[model samples]
Target: MSTPDTTQHKLIVLDMAGTTVADDGLVELAFTAAAERLGEDPATMIDYVRATMGESKISVFRHLFGGDEARAQLANLAFEDAYGELVADGRIAPIPGAAEAIAELKEQGRTVVLTTGFARVTQDAILDALGWRELVELTLCPSDASGRGRPFPDMVLAAFLRTGAVDDVRRIVVAGDTSYDMLSGVRSGAGIVAGVLTGAHDEPALKEHGATHVLASVAELPALIREFPA
Candidate 1:
């Protein structure tokens, strides 16, 4: 609700989907499209797909679609095809003020890191669309030194390591939009857990999951960073 005190906050971590990109119903559309493509029950798979907000495309698909090989194939095909359609249609854009936020964080001598369940290939397209291919300092995907993904904290720790920041696991802030993002932040013992409603989850859901701070969007980040009473 309040702008976090970030004037001296050396690091800022970001979530990709709602935090940065305009998904245009991509997540849900992927599952529905995949189900139709695979000739399966979309209802049975909805739970897994919705639950996969913080998982890699392959991991999520594998869990939802069932089986390893089929999951990988389906994920690759579904995501690639969906993305291709999205690109061809050309409505994707970075969330408002996202690039500006990244740029300002750098201007303030802060190291900006992006961690997402999205794959590197998918992430590349989103970043390129956002015009942020060179604006960040770490992590193209959830995998780090540890292959583990979100809700496990490996990626968060990886960001800290890459930035050469405090690894005490107590001075980092993980800001995101999904419950999985909150879980990842808390599981990692990030000093702060800031959630935004711009993504799939709302403020109430974020609080239910362990977010101590909730902002309207990443656009309010600078204000949050500059005014926290901490």
Candidate 2:
């Protein structure tokens, strides 16, 4: 008997904020609010936040507060609260065709998982705001994967292990709108590390971080996945 072929099946891991969801600088806005709430200057930390766009929120706060765990926790909580409020204000929307693209991938027999660098609360709030609570079978936040996030590969690997969509890491497809997303994909050994122009980083930055393909938006993802040879 021959082994079943799983090569044609892919486990697709997608980033939320900038790739599937249109961010519109909401992250920075929320960061500013969080910083102000804590009486810290946003100007001092905004650069770091921008530079590490796809990193875990708590991880970002940890660095911003110079590894002071208490300050980091407070800032992370404030950031999540501010972001949740902004989300409740109807500031977020799906990137044009993002939903259709995911549907297409699913139709193609691929498993799609949405991953986020936000905390579980913020992630849930965004999903609820978008009515995407049932969009995919599984959505992962940093906390869901041992508290690790993008640029680390933990969440990507978690998706792989949890979904069992594909047996090989190379059968995984990772897509996002930031350089850190590209790095996470690369680190996870995914076959396709597609970067979109709809978010935080540009083409050069995406490519520099290890994007296998650069797309105009997540809208182009289904086609790209279709074209990849099994």
Candidate 3:
């Protein structure tokens, strides 16, 4: 018998850091470094950062700075600088099997779009580090979306709008490792909201945030999609 075809889903929107790329504490490190420079309590700030994983850096900074735009802008710049330097220093790598997963999905003719909380520069850095400059068909960051990043449906919706391939949001599949990712998919009315554990939030948190399925990582995504009933 032939394998079932489950590429019925039109698009798969993915998160970059922590989901596709190995975070390796680089995000927390950048957050801590920025917090220390800005005179915030590193431990407390890091906890906040953990909770807000998958959200845009400017949004995170806005919350961190008590909604002060100027302060948030300053902090955002610092965080981006720190993260870029880390990426340039060869501190980032693709999560094991992530690249292969993307390749397989693309081979199946599924449009793979990467969405992330990081700005364009940080996003590009990770793409370059992983040598996945052309692996994904499209990439979206907070600024690319008209609205906000994860925890909001803007990035995912933006992907839909930009691609013009996914006619219905319900035919879209959203997968990531954070609660924000789950919430974004749910809010966007996606067909499947899957959570992977290679990153920030755990299973319980993902479920609580509206994830429909949970997997070990993006490496498992191609199999799951392939096994789904068409």
Question: What is residue 195's positional error in candidate 3, in angstroms?
Answer: 0.4
Model 2 lDDT per residue over 124-220, tens place: 9999999999889899998889888889999999999999988889999999989899999999999999999999999999999999999999989
Whole-model Cα lDDT per candidate?
Answer: 0.74, 0.92, 0.88
* TM-scores for candidates 1 onward, in order: 0.86, 0.96, 0.95
What residue runs in model 2 are displaced by over 4 Å at the alpha carbon?
A: 1-9
Q: Write the per-residue lDDT of candidate 3 for residues 37-134, one digit (tens) a residue.
A: 78878887788888988988899888877899998888888888898889889898889999999899889889999999998988888888778888
Which candidate has the top score in lDDT? 2
Give each prediction's root-mean-square deviation over alpha carbons: 3.5, 2.5, 2.0
Q: lDDT tens string, model 1, 1-230?
A: 88554555666778888787768778777667766777777887777777667766666666664567755676657776776566446557777888888787678777789887766766677767666778788754754536566777778878877787554666676888888899888988877789988888888888988997998888887666666554
Model 3's lDDT to the true fold?
A: 0.88
Instruction: Sort by lDDT, best first.
Output: 2, 3, 1
Error of 2 at 1 (Å): 22
RMSD of 3: 2.0
True-structure RMSD for candidate 2: 2.5
